[model samples]
Target: MNWDSDELRAAALKLLLLATLRETKVAAPLLAELEELGMVAPGTRKGEFRLLAQQEDKFRRYLSVRWPEFAETEQAFSARPTLISAIALRALRRAPLKLPAGITQLNRKTWSAWAGAHSKSGCATPPPGILLTSDENLRLRPNAGLQIIGEQGGTLDADVCRALFGELIVPERGFSRNWHVTGVLPWLVLTVENIGAYIDITIPPWLLLVHAPGRNTLLATRFIDRLPATVPWVHFGDLDPAGLDIALSMRGPQTGRTPVPWIPHIAFELLETHSLPLSSPWPTQHLPQKLLEHPVLAWLIAHQRWLEHESIVVLSGLVEDVTKLAEMLRER
Candidate 1:
């Protein structure tokens, strides 16, 4: 599409601001800065030069009209590792509404801010830092280094703590492995534990989100990089195929998470009766064979399309199960 010279100039300025700098600036002077840098090619028309001469409120609409076709902020952020004032990123990600009315809306703006804040070159890969955790007392800063939650660590700003992680903390995962000790019965909640109580008995990430990093153990990412693999665990997820999948993922060879079915086969039967899997695609690949090998899980996977722990009836159920799981840990 043919863009007026001012529009092109405005577009160029945006690229420069997002690519090189983290914030926005008024036009005219910013354009002068661009001209000095040779970003403005010599042949562009004087009418295009009007971009440098125009006020933001006037030219802003022109840019807004071209937003979908031109904005590359999200793409830009995906290309790098960035640092941002902790507060800003949080505000943008959770804000009920994004900003700017058009052009770079809140989502794009936030993502762009992240890109600029991160602004790393392609060759250098950035690692995901811990975002937030339960336990209001806990805090982790990029430069301050890692804080093993249960281990002796430094203090965090209380305000930042509640803001980042929610005030009421749910264990930060939806997928997890459930296990049973020799004496533990099927219907009862089983528990897993690390030395003290790292992640008592929570769902692993993979069961819910795709491509979660299971801990580097027999269990899934749930146990990755942790010092204690022997935590007593409890089974408190839903009574369905998906929960079983989560339990199964946690168990088996390296990531030894076990499947301890709480309301075993109840959801599986309900799902099959409702003809679930027949309605949707079944997960054939990466379906935890070990957890499936458990008589109950196998039957459900074969009959149903999907089931999740969330389908479980009670929220308090997890708390009760966790306590039981922890009690079992104290026994060990």
Candidate 2:
């Protein structure tokens, strides 16, 4: 869904502004989410669509008029403040469209000026914060620090590292003849495509480790410094242009080593073998200059084939491939 369509962008922006007015509490939206809602689709030919840049401008003006104090005046539409506002607004509007047991809830105004606003009565009671979704309230608050979410922290399991890291690790404490201490520690960083996957999936731990960090640990930025210098931080995400771009952005310009793809081989194979089911023709365009040099990205662009992380997860050979890749990286 090219959410950056004029209607969607304007609706998103208005929704964002409405969230701020109501003071929705949540972590800001991630850049990928913002891009999904704003940027042109990948492989789009030059001058395909003029873009909703004009609509965005109008929305910004409306925001400035409606809430000048919180309006964004910047080139990056997904500025922190704007995203945070959007998160808050989404948190407030999460009520299901209809009640359970065949009750109907009508939204007469589909494209309303605001969310959770009523001229006559205002919003109903706000729901508890715990019920908010990641789009509304993400759990990636680094300040909260890192803690194991699944299993218990004693030793780090090899499978856990394989799943979370590309099997990047070095022992934090040296081994002993009588007993190895702390087992193997994770050296790589993982950035999941969806927060739900990050939270819901239970990474079963192999009992071989002397001390395994729980399978479901909430990874945070504050823990990066603890990793070994040799361990390259990698991102696991969709095999699409946007996902690749997100990984590059996370690595920034400073990392000495490229963040290896968690499943580039699979992605390459998918591109070579499968066809995307789209309702309409996608615009044909040359790959972006920055991405052209990358072999995996180049292939995807050349074929105009894109794969979502969810799809990859369900592939028959995913687990085996993931484990094999982990071993390969570990040896490297």
| Candidate No. with top lDDT | 2
Q: Per model, state how many residue pairs clash.
A: 39, 9
Candidate 1 residue 112 Cα shift, in angstroms, is 2.9
Give a tens-digit lDDT track for model 1, residues 141-242: 111111223223433332243346522122333212132112111222232222112222232211111122222223223433132344333343443545
Please, what is the whole-model Cα lDDT of each candidate in the order they appear?
Answer: 0.36, 0.39
Regions of model 2 farther than 4 Å from truth: 1-183, 187-189, 196-219, 252-258, 268-299
Q: Compute each candidate's TM-score over C-alphas.
A: 0.31, 0.35
TM-score (C-alpha, index-matched) for candidate 1:
0.31
lDDT of 1: 0.36
